[model samples]
Target: MIQKSIFYTSILLIVVFISSGFKPYDNQIDKWFDLDNTDEALYIFPSQKNTDYTYLNAPFKGKFFVGYKEAIGFKESQNKYRKVNTLGYMGKYQFGAETLKSIGISDSLHFLNNPRLQEKAFVTLLSRNKFILQDYINKYEGKVISNIKITESGILAAAHLGGAGSVIKFFKSNGERRVKDEYGTSVRSYLKEFAGYETKNIPAIKNAKI
Candidate 1:
């Protein structure tokens, strides 16, 4: 009688546990490669995209890569070739000195003075950032959270404002932990503001340099 009672109790517990619907927590970490990428977590772009697609009227250019960069340029420095912000960020795209050096641009003056080099620097940074955030893109792209649609272009633009880490945090929190710059700009804003541009073509190159 005792053995039968214990067996019935065991069966009852098992059924209750199975019906609870308990499962493992899902996150980006489980989806990434198994490598100690701590050093890569520190890296950090953008134009301020508002309702100003008419900033260029080059026949559907607003939706292309060209329009995307220009809108960002206008937002950064109002399209000024030699713009240097009070915070010491340089050029039309408002690149910080350290970030410029990461892409092989050391001479701050030369970078500010050369429009071609600055343009090259912008694209190179985009390619590298896209590479770093590729997995995030793969996971979050087309998923709407907080009523905002996610896309590769928006991911890169947000990474431009904050680093890839901030973006990862945003996704890990399911869009709850939005980081911000001193200018009161949030990562989520960039993600939403710059969505649906032609940045899918930017090559995902590791260590991309100008």
Candidate 2:
């Protein structure tokens, strides 16, 4: 009788536990990989799409290999080049030759100035994209950028250029190597005023116009 009672109690507890949908470990870790990477998350040009279409636009050079599993699971980057896995993975996100071929070089650039290159890239993107400004802002407001240049030091950003009635803010790094504001103020302060957020790293270069 005692054994039967214990067995029934155990069964009842198990049923209750199952029915409760109780996860002993909160799935906080699952969110480490932001599965839904929006267009904003995409800062690298000559991306997979560009590479895939390289046949039409030959001489492409920006081919990033993005598998469904890895892309969905990317967490944070280590220093700059490597997107360190919060779960399990290693190595920098590799770009392919075809991808590189799709991106046309900036003939107008003479040097690789980060801010200047960033401005150029953003301007080009804005001019070519079919989406509205508001939609672009909403999607890309806080996303980081990466891999548009030849090296790990190639990160760039498109910050809000402040104007009348615009509450937008930008942020600059608060260190000795920080940039300057349009008004000659520290870039850190200027960006903060405009609520500018961080984006991925890209190489800043200046090329002469072709």
Q: For each candidate, what TM-score against the reference?
A: 0.70, 0.16
**Model 1 per-residue lDDT tens digits across residues 1-210:** 999999999999999999898865442223233347453332111224555234553224577899889877876787788998888988988999989888888999999999999899999999989889899899889999777899998899888877778888899988888589767789888889789999877899998997
> Which pairs in model 1 have colliding backbones?
45-160, 47-72
Worst 10 residues of 1 by lDDT: 39-48
Highest TM-score: give the candidate number.
1
Clashes of each: 2, 46
- Candidate 1 segments exceeding 4 Å error: 1-60
